[model samples]
Target: MARNIAFGRIQEDMNKTSFFKILADEDLSSESMRLIPNEFWRSSECKILPPKVTLKVAWGSSWPVNLSPFMGCYLMERKGWEEFLNDNHLGDNEFLTFTNEGNNCITVDIFQKNCVEILKPLNTSSSNVKNEEMSCVDPVIAESNKRKVDSNVYGASSSSSSAATFSLTIKKSHLTLLSIPVTFAKEHMPKVRTKFVIHDPKGKPWEVVYVPSNGSKLFSSGWRFLANGYGLAVGDLCTFRLVRPKEMVLEVLHDSP
Candidate 1:
């Protein structure tokens, strides 16, 4: 399926408005989130508001979030939501307030228990990468790292002939989790949340959790281990070939095509 991913062109800006989101399990697990519908932008007709907006935080970092039209509202698409969630280590019950501080920037203030704002980034990534990689990484192409490749590298084309395969251009924002394309999810992914094995290019199996909700799928809950083990970084093009119903082979190319 040709996914129409032209997010609000990714350049849309927001009108002056404010909204809040209380993180829920489904929202956390899925690839997108819906902003509460309000008077300003209740639909695409409300183009005066941004379909895509920049998310700014207290710490001064900014991320671009794509908002897709949904039932009378906009959905915070997966493009930037994953990185935002992972970078912030957002958990259930957390409260997030998005205030449009002019210039199409949506300022994010994250809060937790009793509505106290969280100010620091929660560091949960493993520090010992070599040890972690050695535990579950397959013997990959040792020489691929030394070369500077382009950004379009792929193990398989998005126009893949096989229903069991897909390719992704990864970035730093997606290291903690990866969203399975909706078309792929609906056809190949398990409907119920399940555990699956993602084997590195060299055949080392990394067990990760599959979360499915609202017709979306994501590899979460242990994905970081796989990313760390594979040594996948921003700009790395990775191909996922499903060799078995519950398993896949992950091929990583450090450079672009």
Candidate 2:
């Protein structure tokens, strides 16, 4: 009699996003660091990225980080990385957190010893100012001045908010069913299957079923027909915005020079 060997199925974790903390090596601190492999870029968990993604590194504000392919791997260039390290006064053994911020951007938070939080005042008092002059100022004028100061402090713009925008890159496997972020699905999707109306870049409306994740609830589904109708391919970037729970707007960004 011959014995048979059985292999167990490989299970994938769908809830986890690409996250890592790296110590400041000579190259990473002074030069560039290699990005995760192509498989990671193409993985269902990482479909929210483009082949040539724009990484906006943010500490207090955001700055564009250069990325290019070298030796079969992407490299976060030295120019911006060096400036970021030097500006933050990072040294050896300092820990840096790299997290995806959606829309092809990443946030880099620096952690070092002896860090302290300091609150800075937005405005300073002027001793030369007279109480009589302040008292005479109109209430409406004072409110307008405060609004201007607040806008300047927070960098507020007149443009629409981008909070509702969602980005994803197409994969070969996505043609069957698109994988959605676990947290997003839990908060936005219905418990049972539902229909969603999505508008494409050309403003064409599409109706598709939205199926919430089952079991561990790692991912959500229902985009096969939409992906096929749009002729999405691997490496193509798609952006979506939820106009309502059952309605959404979509935009496809083509690769440019």
Candidate 3:
């Protein structure tokens, strides 16, 4: 599968400025949007890459994606990548270009299906933006709304919010599904399998289901979304603070790899 891959040279050919990737279904299901060419992996410089990298669009938008070595290739993690894909509505078979801008930053140029021509997504007045609107939210507006939520709700937290904060050191299992201390859950969580909103530090809301099983409490389904967004790893610390009857705020402190 590695041989005859659909990607450009990493650091040698074409002046070593850029590489291209045609998206695939496995990338979506596995939460690895982009893979570095094998040439990059074999390069001496690849040994010193940072744990994270910044992905930039021509527009004034950027995402911080975690970089990990996988299956002899480097892959962009779920944190910044999935959000970028969802926000931009990028689909399978879409073409992408990664241009190294130095200092762990890569400028991404997106191409429409079956074409090498780049699309000017930031040109809102252009037809391209109109067409994109038919599939997903405008990337610019979605990002603005995200910031709005952060500013608005974050400032609204009161002393009452701190009254209910709880902290836990993350374990390997927490990456799969977070477990709430039994004592805290029994005292606060609804007895039934109920849906409640969880606000990340950015104030983005995740509606997670709280399940009680044999005196244990677990956050399921939606919790993974939040975990992935923040790139939670084992040994990280998480603190959750109840802000309202149906809402709580979460803070994640990642451990050094």
Best by TM-score: 3
Clash pairs, model 2 backbone: none
What lDDT, from 0 to 1, does candidate 3 have?
0.60
What is the Cα-based lDDT of residue 80 in candidate 1? 74
Winner on TM-score between 1 and 2 is 1
Q: Write the per-residue lDDT of candidate 3 for residues 198-217, one digit (tens) a residue.
A: 76755566667788899579
C-alpha displacement of 229 in model 1, angstroms?
Answer: 0.4
lDDT of 1 by residue, 1-257 (tens): 00111111111234445566678767574633545455534323334767676765533445667777767666678757876777767776787766554444555767675654453345536331111111111122111222222222222331234336688899776798898888877766767777776766443567788999885588999899889988888899887866444556788888754
Can you write out model 2's per-residue Cα lDDT over 129-214, one digit (the tens) per residue? 11121222233222222221221111122113533455778777666777666766665555666666676633355666666647
Q: List the candidate numbers ranked by lDDT, top first.
A: 3, 1, 2
The parts of candidate 1 lying over 4 Å away from their true place are 1-163
Residue 150's C-alpha lDDT in candidate 1? 22
Clash pairs for candidate 3: none
Candidate 3: segments with Cα more than 4 A from true spot: 1-162
Q: Tell me how far candidate 3 lies from the true structure as C-alpha RMSD in angstroms.
A: 18.6
Per-candidate RMSD, Å:
19.7, 20.9, 18.6
lDDT of 3 at 92: 53
Model 2 global lDDT (CA atoms, 0 to 1) = 0.46
Worst-scoring 10-residue span by lDDT in model 2: 1-10
